[model samples]
Target: AASSGDLNWSLNPTYTGCSITGAVGSQVLSCSLGTVAGNTTLPVIHVQSATTPADCGVVSNQATVATTNGTGGDSDTANVTILCPGLAIEKTADAASVTVGSTIGFTVTVSNNGAGTATGVDMSDPLPTGPGITWSIDNAHTSGPLSCVITAGTLHCTGSLDAGETQVVHITSPTQWTGSGETEVNSCLGGTDNTGVYDNTAQVSASNVTGTPNASAQEAVLCPDLHVTKVADDASVDAGSPIGFVITASNTGDAPATGAFVNDPLPTGVDWSIPEGGSTGPLTCQISAGTLTCSGTLAPGASQVVHITAPTTFADCGVYNNTATFTATDSPQTPNDSDSTSVLCAALTLSKTADAASVNAGSQIGFTVTASNAAGGSVGTARGVVINDPLPSGTGIDWSIASGPGNCSITGAVGSEVLHCTAVDLAPGASESVHVVSATGNTSCATYPNAASLTADNAPGLSANASTQVVNCVIVSPPSPPKQHHPAVLPNTGGPDGRLLGLATGLMVTGGALVLGDRRRRRRS
Candidate 1:
């Protein structure tokens, strides 16, 4: 046979009886055709591809056979083609923009593009680098691979792919990105059938491919944080005493802070002062309607401190408290700090009085003594209260404590005894009274003076005096008259003289009668 078409025909090695006469490209075969009554067929020759290269695409071949050196000969033609493997790759990203400290995802697909199966397939991708961009492959998302590794910012994967088969890979962005408006580029390539391609944009390589495929992504950055606190120098203070306070503000984020201020409302019993000094910036402070405001600025990781003085002037005893707040621009929430203090002192009073101004001797006189504390609740309770009252000496009065507190006792004689009363705890605004009864002594008719004194712990002594008057009276009797006894024997001597004169006259008359009787008897005879 002779060469006929553009296709080159060769002799097969299995055909032992036939051989080529000229060069292989000349395609002239020398073989024996035995003589026969019917038809005879010779050994076969192979047809080679001319239009298609190896492993590129399908190549068609046509062969013709004809009878030579004979009339009315027959001819026949036949066609065939060749086939090879192909590969392709593609890449995609989940996001184009993200914040700092955020993660981004990427996916790569490797596929077999030819009709035949692809073996020993390999895929690789290089890490993306920019002003603030970093990347790494995610092992959890890589699938259908014999072996995979990430070393020195590069990912390598090996596996096999069938006809029209595909494989995928996933990667994540870096943990930090500080650059603003920076772009990140990534790509992937695959190789199979001992062939590969290199990509410029993705910076990756793939087998059985021509050009590289890649993807790009970008991100932005933003960050801000602020805090404040307050404290007082003293937790408790006396009335009208000065108190000091310190307030602090800080910015701990990666961004600057503006329009930051501290607000504090001075309580009713406090008098506030101007702000002293601060750090990181100049501080301006103002007070209006009992509210104090201090303003300043702070950079990243910067702080400010402010000092203030306040005086307390509360009328009664109690507790006082104050709170301060902090605010800033671009901050939605506000924070507060607070402190408290107490004010106190001690006050006491004493008084004495009597039930009557004057009293008779040996009569009872009543006296009342009172002790009180004038401090309110803010100061606290008074402790260790005592009272002493001694009866006066030589006052002609006997005195004793009749009714008093259970802790009181009397010592010495009634006329000069000392009465003592003690109280363990005397609460503020509370009072105690001591009653004493005194009786006058039966001594002389004169005026008697009396006095008593009261004394206590941590207090001054007080005294009171009183006097009583006594009366003395005198008695007298009259004298008797003298008696007379001579009237009883007065007239006996004058009556005896008259009786002697009468006896003499009677004797003369008797003598004259006897003379007349003798003359008459002589005439009758």
Candidate 2:
């Protein structure tokens, strides 16, 4: 027979079972059997421990059944083990700011915690998108043994991380940014542990992480601009005189400008001349149909200069205007600039002539004086023009203006008179004439010389001369009739003898008639 006693049951803290009446390492239970059958089993006891243990080594739990009837005690033990793996990842960017049409780089680093090695590690980074921004990846990764590739605008990487080991992946944006404002870049890391435990444990998972360590970059874009100026060396010039112009073109933008050129229309009434050596500065310039074109290349904040020369052809007095326009590859519709100049020149001429080359003394002679304005550029008004006609000093000649331009005054008298004519204004291509008459004085047969002169403002003086001839006639008287005296004396003697004869007179008459008849007959024969 056996007396009633207590049995003790003990288990490891890692295990749990139905409560026994006692503290740790000292639990007690009463044992009794109502009926003993052949090979019948006592009331069964159970114990259990968690599948995963806090420590990675083997974990154990024990239970002992002892009787106070002075019999031996029996014990049983159970074991379990736990596995853990951790992974940590971080991503960073190379540049904080970038310009349009420029690139940016990114680097990703993955680290492992000391619990266990992480296997089948994978990383993904989606590129940012917006207006004016084009994103692309430059797979230049060299940080670790991980291989990185980009597809569908997303960067994908694959590798493994051992305990306390790390791997790296790299990505670059090779396209230019066209948009503005702040852009966000997000990435994620994921994998599984050797114990088949996923890293999707919590917000900060032991193996996988999402939307962390985002990098931001910036971009800027700009446009090109330009400025132009035109000027002339001389503001006023004479007709047929050369004038020089200097034109400058400049680029005010950050980029180089191609096909930069300036177009200038030649001023009216001006003739174009080839520049020195057929070029000005380094510019290629040409003039066609009264327009001048100068072309060259210009860089940012760079300037080019061109020179042009032309001669004035207008014959009228007025202002002339010239303009130039500048253009470039990047810039269009820029404002143009202009410059102007004046021309001043005049030409005058004088001439004098006589109506006849020779004149008779005591006859009227005519003289003519003319003034002309022959300027080739512009019509010129000649002022204070005077015509001086001084008759021959000793030729006994008198003169006065006749059929002339009338604004003339006669000074001095007759033979040495000076005719002064005033031409207030003379237009270009116009002529003025004055006529003077001179009377010759009675004198011996000789040649007389006469002259006239003219002077005017802004013109050279002129002179002309003419001559006249004087003539006299001579007469001779016939010899007196010396024989007539003898006939008169013979007639008086015949009168005394008239008394002796009527008969004698008859005889004398008859005798005279006979004698005259006989002489006439002899001559006829």
Q: Best by TM-score, which number?
A: 2
Candidate 2: misplaced stretches above 4 Å? 1-14, 17-222, 277-283, 314-319, 344-525
Alpha-carbon RMSD, each predicted model: 25.4, 17.8
Residue 183 in candidate 2, Cα distance off native in Å = 27
Residue 219 displacement in candidate 1 (angstroms): 13
Compose the digit string of candidate 2's lDDT tens values, residues 453-511. 76655445577666655533111223333221222223324353333221212112331
**Tens-place lDDT digits, model 1, residues 85-116:** 46666666555433334465567777777665
Q: Output the lDDT of residue 195, model 2.
A: 17
Clashes of 2: 5
Q: How much RMSD separates candidate 2 from the native structure?
A: 17.8
Clashes of each: 8, 5
User: What 10-residue stretch in candidate 1 is worst by lDDT?
Assistant: 516-525
Q: Which ranges of candidate 1 are over 4 A from the true structure? A: 1-319, 322-334, 337-347, 374-380, 413-416, 444-525
Q: What's the lDDT for residue 15 in model 1?
A: 61
